[model samples]
Target: MARLTAREALSYGMFGNAAMLQNALDGKANISLASRSLPEITRQLRDAIAKRTVSAEGYPEKVGQPAISTELLPWALFEEFESLAVDHTGETVFLPPGAPQNIPRWKNVTFDAKEILELWPIANQQIDAWMNADFANNPLKKRKDRISDCTRAIPCTFATATAAFNRSPSKKRSRGQRATNRP
Candidate 1:
């Protein structure tokens, strides 16, 4: 977003491209380019940059190369920025008045019941292959085993199937973890 805006701003004779890139690196120019609520995150980033603790001073102004790199930001500072970015998801939080409410966001879509039933064997085959190939090395084996169990226990409630498919069954009892829909 900042790069596009910086290019546009450069086209309008606002500032030099190198200076714009530097400002973006410093987190000073991109504040307004981001959502209103995210300005605080940008501000915090700028504060960190100004402290010289997360400096990217030697970056060159190459045309195809990126000016601002997150690699320069330390893990601690990155975590701090991430914590401040908790409120990152809101459809209309930063939009101006009269702006469109829905701008087409990505969502986790689930397969329909028919699709799930049809794909069960393929999924089970993949799981079996994984289990045979690198079962001991992969930490996902436990969850995959649960999914294998869930695949056999078809004609079950979507919630129960999903719970079994997604999670490794715990030794301790939990209310929602019970396979009430199991035949």
Candidate 2:
């Protein structure tokens, strides 16, 4: 099986089919439920629910028996961003409408408006482009291409961080040393 790319992981984590998510979990992909970033999960769930990729019955059966209504989940998730206020009075204070909240701070917490907006459209574009591309006439190839395109477009900060970490040590080596070591 081809290794799941960071972009695919994001898409699967955001709006992947139920079978796809299960497959990802079973395969122990880097972005399994236990290991996936919350933003990625949020994006995946949001996208899936929005696109009807995951139906109410597709939600995992658990003891909590949380109501799994696709219609409500989106609004419930959106409610989290109801206010961006600081309670300076040492008491609970509600933020007024149109408060000038820091957007980056929200991004750090969950899928902020900016990040969601950036990712959602790209996901749609990837799917649409894949449908119209070279794979249009081939069902199997189209599936592969869609997955590839989706995964390629989505950004994975964890992957970027890891790459940076790996490269940091190597960056110290002089160019002459690198050149001399080449085969």
Candidate 3:
């Protein structure tokens, strides 16, 4: 919900992209967040970005990535901008977003290659369960959601599951969901 409008605030920046990526990796959605209270969470996210302090409703204090990684951010205020990027070798290759080639340089890389390489293994070390025990009573997760299917039998490919997420989500959680779902 905060991401839906973050583009304007973030200025199409490579730094902003890195910031948002870290936010996703570090923060989990509050099961209690919904339309009735979305504005508060959006304010919290915006405030966190602006002030570098967090007080989100469902998270423990200081749980998510609050500081942006300056080294990972493109220098020259420039870096190869891409919708998708991969670390292929010594060079970082990226598919540019409709711009002419103007490679950005990272002047002060504080971390070494070993740290970057280790990140992949760390990310893959263990899979975290999406729906924790708190979601045991959620009608959506229990009956309407397709999430459980991915855990059993054959896994659904991205293409196969793309349509599953294409459906319009409800504007708000009904009273039934709110009374029961807590995390």
Candidate 4:
């Protein structure tokens, strides 16, 4: 996923309309929140527009288990569908399946997955530089690094611990007993 610039975020919040910013400042519109990724921003925008909130259901047995269940109002159902569509496609931009055929077209819209991936390294470098600059400018927010040392280690972690049980002594004795009992 692509990380949106602050300028892009401001523009998106206004949607090319100066009145939107004015409304937001005047408390007539909801304030937009900054997020680490575009998808997070989009979700926040959608939630703000719908006046909705999301809560985690519960943790599952495995590490990557998909926690299900969401509560959405009738009018906010479209946002739920959009979330499901994106999750299914594994893409940031997607049109929900079974969209109406007569839906209005969007102009000058292009889908370029490759372009997003190419900018990742540059984006990471820029973000790292910005973080370092911020830290230098503000000592109060300075963070510390922690290190830990392991004192003990176990041997033969992969090798089986018990092999005697697997050696079938009864099977070996069975062959010798059969030869002696043969008529």
Candidate 5:
């Protein structure tokens, strides 16, 4: 049995009269009246509010719960029939004999191979800097410092190479082709 303030009671649509509202706030009268009327109301209100709240369930305790823990079948191990039978539009895409009802969507995203090849030297330099920092025990040079240095170095390398990539290749003439002055 809890008594709510007038403001709280008003928020819950308990009473309209100013004097009655004051009495509720003062904890004198309307204590029993409000509680009796709004006993199950708060539960319904909470349920409604909870539906709108964004929630994640991977914290230590929540992760340990059977409801939160999920098992997934690897796409590589999926049989041809199972792949064909999966509902592509639904939330869960894959299901083996006894697999969980829902599985997070796994995407096979790929980077531009040529772009990656171009960045290889930059990656090597960053790795070397990181190793050197670790060996030297440099307190100021953190992982992010190495990244920042690499980012700074990349623009200079990119500027020099920009012209080469941007230049349109000259079209070569075929063996049979010859220059003819025809306008």
Candidate 6:
């Protein structure tokens, strides 16, 4: 936790992540209060989200023994279901499932995940450079680096993104065509 914002609490951050984090934080838009507590809250929140039941299989023994409860059919018990059920969660937050939408939202569009993986090294280099570069912390961009925030940020380098875009096969398609992907 020290590596993350130097506090026991976690910050989902603002501006870009504000809405999504707001949706995730339990109390609607009152997310700012989450940065003031312990990690146990997060664990409890995850349990609350995935917890289905605490049911007893048998009666307690006669000698002041307690009944042990079992978690029945909770989503976390199954690895595959966890992906479907939980979009995101933490101790202090659980983002509800979002509305499903078309992946490309356009006909004749597709993605090759392998190709993206191949380009990851270049993307990583750009990201490292961006992190090590001065001005990443500035509220305003430096004049020389201000072609656009894309040039100063990770994964949005014009040359690399444009090259990847151009590498993809795009074309005018007939109305009958459908988009597909391998990602």
Which candidate leads the pack in TM-score? 2
> Stretches of candidate 1 above 4 Å error?
1-36, 62-172, 175-178, 181-183
- Give the alpha carbon lDDT tens digit for every residue of 62-150 in model 3: 23544333333332122223231222111222334453455442212222222222221211111122222213334355322444442
Provide the lowest-lDDT 10-residue window in model 4: 146-155
- Cα error, residue 148 of model 3, in Å, equals 8.2
Residue 69 error, candidate 6, Å: 25
TM per prediction:
0.20, 0.22, 0.18, 0.21, 0.18, 0.19
- Weakest 10 consecutive residues of candidate 6 by summed lDDT: 1-10
lDDT of 6 at 17: 21
lDDT of candidate 1 vs native?
A: 0.32
**Model 5, span 57-168: residue lDDT tens:** 1112233344344233233323322321112111222333455534333222122222222222233333344334442443233334444553343322443333322231
Off by over 4 Å in 6: 1-84, 91-148, 161-183
Off by over 4 Å in 2: 1-13, 28-122, 132-183
Tens-digit per-residue lDDT, 1-183, candidate 4: 343322333223333221333455568856552214345544553343244332111112224554343222232443545542121112222343445433222211212222322222122232333334443444232122100000001011112111211221222223224333222
Please give the ranking of all candidate structures by lDDT, highest first, separated by commas: 2, 1, 5, 6, 4, 3
Whole-model lDDT for model 3 versus the true structure? 0.28
Candidate of highest lDDT: 2
Q: Which 10 residues in a row give candidate 2 its minimum summed lDDT? A: 84-93
Global lDDT scores for all candidate models: 0.32, 0.35, 0.28, 0.29, 0.31, 0.30
RMSD of each: 20.6, 16.6, 18.1, 25.5, 28.5, 19.5
Candidate 5 lDDT trough over 10 residues, lowest sum: 52-61
Candidate 3 off by > 4 Å: 1-21, 24-128, 137-183
Clashes of each: 0, 7, 1, 0, 0, 1
Please give, for residues 14-96, the per-residue lDDT of candidate 6 as tens digits: 21122334444545545443332324433332343355321111122224545354222333432222222211221111224
